[model samples]
Structure formats: structure tokens, C-alpha cells
Target: MLTTAPFTELAAQMTGRVVTASDSDWDAVRQAFNVTADLRPAAIALPRDVDDVVAAIAYARAHGLRVAPQATGHNAKPLGTLHDALLVDVRALQEVAVDPAARRVRVGGGVKWERVTPLLAEHGLAALHGSSPDVGVAGYSLGGGMGWLARKHGLQASSVTAIELVTADGRFARVDADHEPELFWALRGGNGNFGVVTAIEFAVYPVAQLYAGTLFFGLEQAGAVLCAWTALLPDLPDEMMTWIKLMRFPDIPDVPAEVRGQAFTIVFGAFLGDEEDGRALLATLHELGPAVDTFAMAPPGVLGDMAMDPNDPLPYLSATALLDELPDSGVEALVAAAGADSGSTLTMVELRHMGGALARRVPGAGARATLPGELGMFSLGVPLDEASAVTVQAELDVVSRAVAPHKVGDYPNFVEADTDARGFFDEDTWSRLRLVKALYDPSDVFRGNHPIPPADVRSL
Candidate 1:
């Protein structure tokens, strides 16, 4: 049991809400966005501003408790019951400022993509954001954010110009390429293992709108469509990006009749240019005869909604891998594992194209600036019961094994819970990350998702 003395004093110093296990709202405060993360921290503290965050960190240290800073908890699957830590909730630190003339945006720790994208749209500018609008900006960008425009502009982490963070020693510091250069590099793609980021400033493009949407086809054509898709990757223009998704709908009554219990193959695409050019470039896909096509010219915000990601939280298991190449053989393996004929419990299998600008690593950029693979493959499994969970787990295992030969590394954001951080980077990059951790947070005060331990403490 955790003593209340330090918490009591901490509450007196904070101008924010502090919920303990004894509070009436403990159940709600302790739960993460993903239902699977039933975190039971000693206490949950909501920091309203930068000062409050510093106070919370100091109080945790004073009481021999670590501070696990989280904003929306969207990627909290790996964080189990945090009984030994104080969960610092940064949702109340919502602040956004845009320099339209400079083509940059400064976002708070709590701001979501939905909130920031529309704001930038007003100025005829846009930033790189994830598929879901509900995902927190700071957390997403910190893990190397990938979006529809990534092929042209590169990862979001590479665009970061500055970050305001409260270090483990309770000091507020501004990190940029010239200031705290190593820490700045680590913070951009370093998984937020060193400090609590209060705000971040990143570059945005002068794009107002683009042609984006999905082309849907019945599952029977999945094998042929996927093979063609793989063949087209090498010829795609830098201004465009595409991904293929194979989804199996459940037989639940709530599902629409058109897709209930049936599988569908979707070819979703986005291009950053004029409508006429976009259509002309995508004409080959139209010749393939999709059952339905929803592609059209729309605002950049529409990219977040194109995937139809769940707006609310639920229990699910997800895994991802980076592939050095997605040849015909790899596509065939993907189809056999989760396509029409496979009685799989997995809900979705997606292959996102990587390269173009992603292949060019910026000089003096962060650890994630370079693309490790040509494609990123992800799988999602939703289980409603113990038996269903077992089935989904089995299918996921089979899917992983099928693509094992093509696997290289993995994107930090898409990696599963309990996965070692070493796989996300090369040997030299991992060593550099460990050294940064040792210098900034030697005691490992913040062991958040995909943690990188201090260098000297490792078992060599």
C-alpha cells in the first residue's frame, strides 16, 4: 500500500486534480484509453500547466515513486498496472499556436490531431498527423508520426524544430538542434523516455487540400489486387502514398448488411496535388474495376477519417513489422494468412508503402529519420471472449511467422507491448539512445512505453 503523506503535500502544491485510489473517481482515472490497460498507479495527477508538471515530478521523487507521464493513453498496451508509479495526466495542458507566415505550428502536450489539423487548414497549411484524429499530437510525433503525406515530407519527428520538456531533475529546458543537441535528437524519436514534454514546434506544408479516399472491392479479388498493388509501389510518385487493407467483418447484428460476416479488400490512397493530375496518375487502379470508389478531392483533415478508425476505445491486440521488401512472395503470404479463404479471427491486415522521402535521412536528424524498410505491415485482432482471444492470438502468430522472412525492423509507434526497444533501431542507434538516457535520466524515472534503459545499468 502507498502512503498518503507525500501525495497530500503534492496536492497542496498542484493547481490541478489529483485522484487517489480512495477517491470516488479512481476507477475512471486509473483506466487507460485501451480497455486492456488496467493501470492502478499509486495516484493519478493531472497537471494543468508546466509548473504543475514540475511539481508533480518533484513530489514523485520525494516519495520514492517514479513519474509516468501520459496524455491520452492511446498507446498504453505495454503499461500494465503501474502500482509503483504516479501517473501524470497531461490532458489539461491544451494550448496551440500557429505561425502561418513561417509555416509552423506549436502544439501542447494534450492537443489531438483533430484539434490541430483544422486549425492549420485555416491558414492553408498542414502538419503530419496519424490516421486517428483522437490520438495525442505530442505522443504521436514523439514516436515518429507517419501519415498520408509522409512520402513527400518525411516523418513528423523529422519536422520538429523545438520541444519544451521538464527533465527528470525538475528543470524546464528547451530542446532543439543546437540546444541540447543530443537530447533533442533523442526526444524527437526517442520514445519520451527522458522527460515530460510540455509542447512541441514542428514544420507544416503550404497544402490546402488534396485528392484522397478508398477504393473498395470484394474479398474474392484480394489476391490479384494485392499482387498488382505490390507491382505498382516502385513506380509511385513522391507526391502520392497508398496502402492496402484486408478486413473481415463480424457477424454481429450491429454490423451493416452489406459487409456483415464478409471480407472486403480496400485500396486506400492519397495524393498531394491537383485533382486532374491525381486522377490521371491513379487511372490504372480504376481499370481494375473496384466494386465501389469513394475517391474525391477533399481537405487534408479527411485523411484522418479515411481509414474509419474507431473513435472510441476498446479491447484489441495489434502487431506490426517493417519489411525490407514486399515482393510478390510476401504479398502472397499476406493473402494466405488473412485473406478470403483463411478462417482467421484477425479483423484487419494492412500494408503501407514506405520510401520516397522516407528513404532520404536528413543530416543531423533524429534516430528515426531513416526508413529501415520499404513497407510497413500491421495486423489488428479484436477478441470478445477468452476463446475468441485465443483464436485471434493464434491467427496473429501465424501471420507473424508467414512474414518472418521479410521482416527487418519496426516502426516504434506500431510495435506491440513487451517488445524490446532494440528491434526498433540498429545497434549503433540503440547504444546512442542508452547513452542519452543515462545522461538525462540515470535512475530511469520515466519508464514509459518502449522504454530505453540507461547504458551503465545494462547487463553486458
Candidate 2:
């Protein structure tokens, strides 16, 4: 049997808070942002800094327990169970440092894009951050973060220069290209199967302004707008990036009266060059005569909020896939599944165009660099009741099957609960990840969000 005496003693020595099931706040401590995950971990440790993380790992090891590190818990659905493990809450480890001369920034495990983006903006520098500012930097980078500047800078993981982590053996180590080279490679895009990262350092870019905004049109014009946008995509420079979203806002007090219960098609984009040329390039989209237009020149700090992602926690189901092409047939399939006429109570349906810098794989960088397809397809369902849940799920299945022919696997960061881990990587890449998992986490002490099993367990 596992001993509790040592755990009690370890908790007494920690500078951070350690809560057990008996604690009044245990329910809140073990909760994830998605709300679907009702995790009941043996203990939840909120580490304030790097030392606290080290101590938590050591204590878990002594008691023969696993450690699962979580920052914002954005992608917690894939984390199977934590009954025999300690959930390391690193939200208090918020540290951010920027070196403008070297064009690099260092962030703590718990740091969010919201905090770092503004800090880097002071020096006219920008880090590759995901669409939402609330997303944790470490978790996002580990999963191959896709950002607004991705077309020019590439995935967030590609810019990583170093990682400081507490390994399964309770040892603190620094991994980089020149140090622990193999481990560094796995840590980049391999997810968090190796250890509890304390801090990560990556290069940033010198950017001050960008022409970005969203244009909205009624669902009646979706077909025409979608076709025009797709046709115009090829003519745009590598500095331009865009996506199309089909949304049906709910009729509620929280939603604006103007768009409440309204179904519309919106085109979102950002251009990296000067406003004049950017405007000229996007003039055609303007001619399409969207019902609403909000394009403007904005500071780098505003990029995080551009996508308009909800900051609060809620119950939802999401799925993601890469699309090789979006022909007329594909657009029809998309509209038929989640569009206004589909009768699906989905909150959002998006098709993000991918290519440019996102198409070129960085050599010896990580397991994944470039997307396997030309676009990313994401759908999210919001079910208010059991019947609604069933209805949305059925519709999601129809959407998946309809676009199955164009799918070419999925992006790791976009992967969700039901997706198989192997689908995120190719056969060779998955095999290499297994070996790396064996090397760093032989006993499988760290059970991260999307785990890569050890080599020995693959055959079984």
C-alpha cells in the first residue's frame, strides 16, 4: 500500500499549498477550464515557483505517485485520470523576462500569452502566441502553438531555444540544442510527457504594427464570400494570413441584441506589411460588401484578442482536422454540416488557411513543424441539455464524414479528447516520440494532457 505519512511530511515542507480530498477547496483545485473533466486527483499542489515544483515532483516520487502539471487547463480532456497522481498547479509561477538585444524572451511555466505579449510590445518585439491571450505559454508551445504571425514566424515551438524542467527522477535539468539535445527536440512538439517544465526561453520578432480585422456577412452570402476569399488567397503575399468562420450566436442576455440568434459568415485576417499595401491587397474582400467591417492598423499587443475567444470556462465539445483543399464541394459540405441551415447548435465552425511559413518544416527542430494540409478545420458544439448534446454530436459526425476525403491528419495543438494520439504524428515521428518517452519517463511518472507512451508499452 502507498504510504501517507511521507506525503504529510512533504506537504509541511512545501512553500506552496498542497490540498487533499478532505480540503474544502479540493473540488475547485481539481477543476479544469473545459468543465467536462471532473478530475479527482489524490492531491493538488499549487507551486509558487521552480523550487516548489521540484519539491512536488520529489514528494510524488517518494510516495510512488505520478505528477501532472497544469497551467490554465485549456486542453485537459485528454488527461485520462489522476486518482493516483498529484496535480501540479503552476499558475503562481508567473515570471517573464525579455532580452531585446538578443530578441529573446524567457517565461515561467505558468505565464500566459496575455502577460507576455504586452511586455514584449514595449521593446517593439513579439512572441508567437496563440489566438487567445489566456492560453499558457509553456503548454501552447509544447503543443505547437499557431498564432496570428504564424505565416511569417512559424509555429511557437520552432522558436524555442531552451527549457528548464524537473525530470521524473526529481532532478532539475536545462535542455537546449547544445545541451540535452535529444530531450530538447522531444520537448518542443512532443507535448508534456517528459517532465514539469519550470521555464522556457524562445526568440521573438521585431514587429510594431499589423493590419488586422474581421469582416462579417449574412449567411445568405456565405457561398459567394467563401468562394471569393479562397480564390483571392493564392494572390496574397506570404505576409498575409486569414480564416473564415461560420457562427450562429445564441439569443441570450450576454449576446448583443444586434447579432443575437443571428447566423453570419465572417472573414478574419491579418497582414504583416505596411497599411497601404495591406489595404490594397484586401480591397477585393472589401468589395464583396460585408455587412460589417472592422479592419484597422493595430499594435502587437492587440493580436492576442483579435480572434475574440471567450475567456470564461464552459461546457463544450470540439474537434479539429487538416484539410488538403477546399473546393466547391468541400465548402458545400461544411455549410451543410454546421452552417445556418444545418440545424446544428454548434457555437463556431472555422476554416483557417495554412501555408507560407507554416508549410516549410524546420530541420531538426521538432517532430512537427509544418501543417500536413493547406487549411485547418475546427468545429465546436455547445449543448445545453442531454438532448442537445446528442443532436450536436450527431451533426459533428456528419461534418467529419463529409470532409473525410480532404483530411490529412490533425495539428497537435488542435487535437481534442476523442482523437487518438498517434493521429497527431506520422508513423516514424510517433515511434521516435515513444523512444524519447522511454528515455525520460521510463516509469511514466508524468501523465501530461496528451501522453506519448513509453517504447516498451507500445507493443502491448
Candidate 3:
């Protein structure tokens, strides 16, 4: 059993509160965004500033405990069994500074995309943010962030100009291309293994408006819709990003009335071009005759909620894969596995178009400069009970098998479960990442969601 008595000194050293297992709000403090993730950390430090972060790291190190730096805990499921760790919750470090003139923004680690998207929209600027607006900017960027602009602008990590963090040694450091380039490269894609990130600065684009929205069809038409969508990808340009989702809308008050309690095969997209060209490009999908078409010109801010990801915590199991071009047979197999008649209770099965800028590595790029795949597939199911969990796991497995043949790799950001982080990169990149970890965090004091141990420690 853990006690607050040991944290008295640590609490006195910081302005933020230190939550222990003995505290009344321990359950609330230790909870992750994924309700299923039962995080039982030795203690949780809600750091209000960078100084408190440094103090938390020092305290954890002195007490022989590993430190896990987290903001929103979106992917906290991977940090399994945190009994020997101190979770430095940085949600209190909410800061947002946007310089529209320079096309740059610096946000505190705790800042979520929702907090910045609308502000940037007002200035006719946009960042490479993912589907959900609630995801923390720090965690999303630290992991390889992919979103609507990904096909044209590339991953959010590559756009990062600077990252400020408190390293394992309790020192504050700001790493950029010209300063600590090695660590900068690793932190962008390698995650928070070496330190606790306090803030991140990245470039935004001047996107005043674009043609974007969803095309909804009956779930029964999934196979036909998917086949047409795949065929249309070859003719699409980088400026046009699209995804097809087989979704079952829950009968909840939070969901829009029209989509509530309905299942549909939805084709959602954002095109950085005029409505005429966007409509021309999507003519094939339109010919299929969607039940409801919402295509129209909209500001970048609308893209944040376009995907309609759940904003609340829920128990769910997910599976993901990076896939090559899918043949007609592959499409049929996918439909057979998760379509309307598959008896699958999964909430969503989505395949996002990936290529163009997303597959090209530019000069001065970070460790995760490019992803390898023509499409990225992600699926999830909410398991309300033990029986439902087993059913969900089985359906997820079937969906995995459907795409297993064309599976190329996995995106670290989409990989929620704990696994070998090395698999996310090539041998050389993995080796270099380990070396950086050895140099900066030789004792392995920090624990990332996907932990990458030091080179020397790995050999042992």
C-alpha cells in the first residue's frame, strides 16, 4: 500500500498537488482517458509549471521510481502496471501562444487541439491535427500525428520547430534542429522516454477555407462503396485527403439526431481546393448516390470535429494496420468481416488514404519523417461486459485477418497496446534511438507509452 506521508516533501516543493493512493481523489487522479486502463501509479504529480515538472522528476529519481510524463493520457493503456512509476500529469500546464504572422504556435504540454484549433481558425491558419480535438497537442505531436492535412503537409512531428522539456537529470532543455538535433529527432517520434515535455512549437498553414464534409450511405453498400473509394484513390491529388468508415452510431443524446442509432458507410474528406474541383474529384462517389451529402466549403476549424470521435471516456478494444493497395478481393473480405451482415458489434472500421507527403521524407525531417503504406486501417469496439469483450476481441481479430495479407506496418500513434517499440522503426533507426536514450537517460528513469530502453540496458 502507498501513502501520502512519503510525498509530503515532494508536495511542499511544488505549487501543484501531489496525489497518492491514500488520497480521496486517487481514483479520479489516476484515471486515464480510456476507462479500461486501470493505472495504479505510486503517485501522480499534477505539475503546474516546468519547475514543478523538474521537481517531480527529481523526486521520482531520488525515490527510485520511474517517471511517466503524460498530458491527456489518450494512449495510457500501453503504460501497463505503473505501480513502480510516478505519473507526472501536466494538464495544469495550459498555455497557448499563437504568432499568426510567423505561421507558428507554441502550446504548453497540457494544451489540447480543441483549445487551439478555433483560435487558429480565426486567423485563417491550421495545424496538422488528428481526428479528435480533445487529444493533447504534446502527446499527439510526440507520437507521429496524422490527420486531414497529412497527405499534403506530412506528420505533425515533422512540423515541430522546437520542444522544451525537463530531462531525466532534472535540467530544462529546449531542443531544435540547430540545438541538440539528435535528441530533437528522437523526441519527435521516439516519444517521452528521455524527459517530460513542457511545451512544443510548430508551424501552421494559411488555410482560409476548403471543401470538406461527409457522404453517408447505407451500411449495406459498404462493399460497393469501398471498392469505388479504392479505385478513386489513384486519381486523387495530395491536397485531397479522404477516409471511409463503417460506423454504427450509438443511440445517445450526444450524437446528432440524424445519425443517431443508424449504421452507415461514410466517406469523409477535406480538400484544399475549390468546391468545383472537389466535387469533380468526388464525382464517382456522388454517382453512387449517397443518402446524405454534406460537401461544402468550410474553415479549418470544422475539420477538428468532422470525424465525430467520441469526446468522453469509454471502454473499447482497437486494432490497426498499415496496408498496401487493396484489391477487389481484399475489399470483399473486409466487408464480409465487418459489414452490416457480419454480426460484428464494432463501433467503427475505418481506412484512411495514405501517401503523397505522408510517404515522402524531406530534408531535416524527424525520425518518423514518413509512413509506409497506401492506406491506414483502424477499428474499434465498445465492450460493455465480459461476454461483449470476448465478442469484440473476436470481431477485431477477424478484421485484422481481413487486412493481414496487405499489412505493411503499424503507426506508433495508433498502436494503443504495449508492444516492442522497435518494431515501429527500421533496425538503424531503432539503434540510433537506443543510443540517444543511452546518452540522455542511461538509467532509464523516464517511461514512455512505448518504452525504448537504453542501448546498454537492452544488451543486458
TM-score of each: 0.95, 0.95, 0.98
Order by lDDT, highest first = 3, 1, 2
lDDT of 1 by residue, 1-460 (tens): 3445637788889999888978988888776767877888889889999899999999888787878888888887776777788888899888999898988899888888888888877776778887789889988888899888889989999999999999999999998988999999998788769899999999999775588888888887888888888877788898888988898877877667877887889999898887788877777777789988888988776776677677677778777888888777877887788888887768888889988888888887897786678888889899888788888888988888778899887888987586788878888988999999999999888966888888995555
Worst 10 residues of 1 by lDDT: 1-10
List, residue by residue over 165-222, the lDDT tens digit for candidate 3. Answer: 9999999999999999999999989988979999999999989559999999999999
User: lDDT score of model 2?
Assistant: 0.83
- Clashing residue pairs in all predictions, respectively, total 0, 0, 0
lDDT of 3 at 227: 94
What ranges in model 2 sit over 4 Å off?
Answer: 1-7, 256-258, 457-460
Query: What's the TM for model 1?
Result: 0.95
> What TM-score does prediction 2 earn?
0.95
lDDT of 1 at 372: 75
Worst 10 residues of 3 by lDDT: 1-10
Q: State the local distance difference test value for candidate 1.
A: 0.84
